[model samples]
Target: MLGVTSVDLADRRELLDRLEQYYDAVPRSGARVEDFGPLSLFIREGQGWPFYVRPTLGWSGSVSAADVNRVRVRQRELDIPESFEWVAETAPALRAAVEQAGLAVHEHPLMVLGPDVPAPAVPEPADGVVVRTVGPDDLVLPSALAVPHLAFAEPGTGGGAAGLAELGEVVRGRAGDGSVKRAVARILAGLTCVAAAVEDNTAVLGGCAEDASTSGRRIAGARPVAW
Candidate 1:
């Protein structure tokens, strides 16, 4: 059995609000959300990524099979994969419905740091390693795609070029609106890359291993907006 604390209710509401605002900030170019009662159907048109947003529901409220079918019909209409993200603690009914539809369920950990927690320390980079901020214009999408692809390259798989090319197309598509630049800058500020190198102000790195928070709550360009 799962235990619920008094704080859980407050946290759930806050999380939902944050998620809604984050999706709202998504560019108007290819982003749209179709509200389905408590579920927000998020579609990034042409990107082939559609996500269902499920809010915390009361135990008395159970997800119906109709809800599952609705999602299926919509995905079929869009010709996109079926996917939804919801809090495990609050989505028992929806979980069962999706599983019954034979779709694989994936659960991911949600992490949040409070002001009281001490900020994590950034490790010293190895010798000859240099880390610097590179603007969007300074780096090509191919080089950005290479960072993760090269880092995760296997011994003899040998599909790096093709995979990188496909990813480059997607990256360039996203970069056109400059949203990718803002997002990456926001990410790298909080997460320090350990094996990163700056050549001509462009970065190629291994992995991020640090939280980008300070003692205060400021993150990169903007302060956390209250909802």
Candidate 2:
């Protein structure tokens, strides 16, 4: 769960709008854009799942079953998995419209921390573990990324079978799928930030942390747009 307590709805709505605008404007690596009136489909070029179907930036009219049907038909034509994403509060009608189109609608709780919210204090890493922000050029980035896979796979402080070789294999596999390159592009383009925890000269665990609000209007040269 994300931050929900003591939230101001107006401020949160502004941030959500910002996020939606940013996502619509920014380039998603390994995906191509296909627009259909109120919806924009992010189709995967190769590898991985299709991105998603989302309301276009600045879309405000109520979404209807016919609207959902058009996008679904296009997705089926393209052979991509059917998926729709939006904020329930902002898109109250979309849920019903999607369900009416015979696609399952799932609600995901969202936590929006506006610029007004003070960041939480940084916690100390475990002894022998160092937590730090990872730069795009950092040699340990792949290992930093692999830590999350290891962390969830085993769910413990110990490294277990999830070590450099195993993690390296994971990284190599991502490279083949262009995930590594795309992730690096995102970091370099200021679209996201990465943090890592290192142990034994390796990011053994607690790595692959993403910093939100790393993009959108904050990015250099991007036109200012409300989310």
Candidate 3:
């Protein structure tokens, strides 16, 4: 049993690494990469604000007053195009910076899953629901996979469409690159549930779950889905 668990974890890790690589490769429009020696940053132009990602840290960036003002100025300089969002890990330095800058701080917990754990019990489909695995050739699959958790999310705090698209790109890229082997999709009553499994034959490294319900439906009694 212990050996089986180890193999599961390994598989999860491999999938996660591949997903990270995919995100690193696909650049977003107006997205900029900043290298801070110990960290790398991905910044994108958003609808109302700029979106940011720190794949290395596994956390989203909070806005500082400085960041807030800087972004505002940039928007004007860039002709105030569209809404934007930013992301980063909640490190001490980052937290302090955002706080000192007078930007409100929002917290999002990072979750992970491993192979020793049992597979998520298949969810019951709602009326008129259909579930299917998204194939690699389906370009729309990536966009669909990228939808964020909106029902359990706070207002102005969820990763909207662009964020979801980014996520989908990562999942597809990793799976295609031999970093992941198994990915699943569940759609019930016109809503969707997606899970990405990354593991070797033995252990699971990590997994992520997304509830894609148009009516903001959620999976009740569902365990933490791996990512």
Candidate 4:
């Protein structure tokens, strides 16, 4: 039977693979990933505690105690905290391994919106509220910034401010069509607004990459990788 998330075990593996590849392509400032047989270790320097180890397909089976120890060893080597993503439906074994390693488990919603899905219209806000996108050139402006970090904070913690900016910089640098800046500018211009068509750029909204893996090249959502 399928799990609470609706994705069956077999399909979940495929989806996980795409998500992994998608994350691999993203440009993180000081984060490095190391493959260790059953899982991949992501060690990020600075911006608070680091170290996150995860298996691409946790449903494959229970990980050996030795494998879990490897993750701890790497965390100690980097002097960082221990954390990783455990899918509700497919990570039973990974979850067991981590729990055995004496780490707490937390859950967060992993949402996905496909291209074929129609986007809802932007809502109207109360009086005195304004909204719009942050223009490409205005990315450096202090007033125009500050939304990203809080929006994309770590799951349990407050926020990843440095990581947000670094990711923004990477998106900006890689932006060839000026869509990234335009999207930001639009969001900033009005407190309630939606960028209808953003092409070839990175978009941050609702605290995550809204355009991930889209043909429009917006934020690159799961569709590109999942299908």
lDDT for each residue of candidate 2 in 29-54, tens digit (9 for 90 to 100): 45788877778888887553357888
Candidate 4, after superposition: displacement of residue 170 in Å? 22
| TM-score, model 4 to reference | 0.54
2 versus 4: better lDDT goes to? 2
Give the runs in model 4 whose Cα sits over 4 Å from its true position.
1-14, 27-30, 45-51, 56-62, 126-130, 139-227
Q: lDDT of each model, Cα atoms only?
A: 0.50, 0.66, 0.39, 0.50
Predicted candidate 3 versus true structure: per-residue lDDT over 25-127, tens digit per residue:
4333235765533234455533212344333435445434465455445545656432322233224455465566555666665444444678679876544
Query: What's the CA error at residue 72 for candidate 3, in Å?
Result: 5.8
Measured on C-alpha atoms, candidate 2 has an lDDT of: 0.66
lDDT of 4 by residue, 1-227 (tens): 54446456546676666565455444233357777777778776433224467674333645776788887888787777666665555456777777777778776678865557897796774344444443435433222232343444444444444444565564455446443444455345432133211212333332223333423333444211100
Tell me each candidate's TM-score.
0.55, 0.70, 0.38, 0.54
Tell me how many clashing residue pairs each candidate has.
1, 2, 46, 26
Per-residue error for 221 in candidate 3, Å, reads: 22
Candidate that would win on lDDT: 2
For model 1, residues 1-227, the per-residue Cα lDDT tens digits are: 16977698787676654543443343222447665654556676443224554442323466766677676788789876666767664455777777877778877666666557897996876566565443334453234434554444444434344443444454555555554454355355543223235444334442332232333332322211100
Compare candidates 2 and 3 on lDDT and give the better one. Answer: 2
